[model samples]
Target: MNLSRPLLLASNSPRRKELLASLGLTFEVRVKEVSEDFPDTLKREEVAEFLASHKADAYKEDLQEEALITADTIVCLDDKILNKPASAEEAYAMLRALSGQTHEVITGVCVLMKEGKTVFHDSTTVYFKELTDAEINYYIQHYKPFDKAGAYGIQEWIGMIGIEKIEGTYFNVVGLPVQKLYENLVQLKIVV
Candidate 1:
């Protein structure tokens, strides 16, 4: 596909930008603050996907003839959704809650086409080994993963030393599901 249309990424996440760059696709970043709130009635995955689609809708007017990509990721453990922490204390609390447990990292992506077509969402499971107070404290103090969901980055020291296993895409835990995004892009003929 030799498309000349530009691609727009509607997010301020550096990780998502870097992940998309890895695909060698030319794109421009357009960050718009959208409410991340979702109805409490929605389940875990539905909540995530709903937010993602809502983000995409915020950029609809700016889409032009290009495809716009928007996404939302959440960490779920025992039906609880863990988003980015509001403070250092919250971050610490989230990490402590995740210690020695398996969690689901669900990423909802909305790829909006120029012709009004769209596709979205993917989920990955990650497991963390039991972490001591020292381990969690050290990681919180050092990494300070305030911008990441679940208060941790899978590519950081915590994941290196604390994650025991993962059942799905590693990139999904990082932020975006590149493989799934690529497949959808291909189907949309957005990239060769």
Candidate 2:
């Protein structure tokens, strides 16, 4: 499919870039520093969507005529949001909370066309088997998942041995929900 305008991904996440590439779409990356702060009163899913849109808004002036994509993923467990871990101890704690439990991974995506706008979100429920302290410690020390949400990556060692099941898109847990984003792009007339 030949598109009139090029595609721009306004994110620095390698996972999102890989996911987008899997769809066979050629794109360019432009990273911008945007504040992710949101109102604490916003609900979990709302927070994700808001932040994703906020990132997209940062590139409005630089969008030109190309379609821009921005997204944010959050791990929510028991009403708390688990983002990137600040320290090894935090990573261990986040993993412990997810062990032998089901948590929701919601990814909010914003697809901004030159003249059209579309925003949507996808969520996946991940279930982790009980994790021993040794397993958690080993993964933390070996992998250092400080850049991943919930202190883990679905495509990493911890996920291979810890996640027992998932009720939604597996890619969403990694970062971006490609299937959902593709559909939304078509709906917004960004791609056909």
Candidate 3:
């Protein structure tokens, strides 16, 4: 259902934009530069929501009638957060650590309105098949997933062959927990 007010998505991720579009909601992409930094004291599960909340804070004064949406995603292994890789080598190392292991993908979403704000998160367990050294190298060179958390994309080639299983929402692994986001939007009356 169309909303009474405009929807503003404060993210530059094409994946997130596409996911929101798939829900049949009309929105405007209003990019804002928000740092991904979080307190070192924050737990792995809390980091994403903290960051997403910060993203919303950056535009709190500008929320006229537009409901704003922001999100953050992270990959966790053994309680350690794996953010986007800065280099191909880092991506390879992150992927190697994930090989044959079950890791967690968490995404935090924030929906802010002039009246109130909602912040929440969803996590998924991803199991990867044992990957050969050559396979890791080839994937890094071919897919260039340095921008994605966990050094990989669940919808990309590495995910198709490397990811053995997932225990939660697949879209959460892709960077946005769209199902939960949709539910929150409806609850907040952003969509009918």
RMSD for all candidates, in order, please: 1.3, 1.1, 0.8
Candidate 1: which pairs clash? Answer: none
Per-residue lDDT tens digits for candidate 2, residues 46-146, read 98899999999888887778998899999999899998999999999999999999999999988887676678889999999999999999999999999
Which residue pairs of candidate 3 clash?
none
lDDT of each: 0.89, 0.89, 0.92
lDDT for position 24 in model 3: 92
Instruction: Give one digit per residue, the lDDT tens place, for model 1 in 149-170.
Output: 9999999999999999999999
**lDDT (Cα) of model 1:** 0.89
Error of 2 at 48 (Å): 0.9
Q: lDDT of model 3 at residue 9?
A: 94
Name the candidate that leads on TM-score: 3
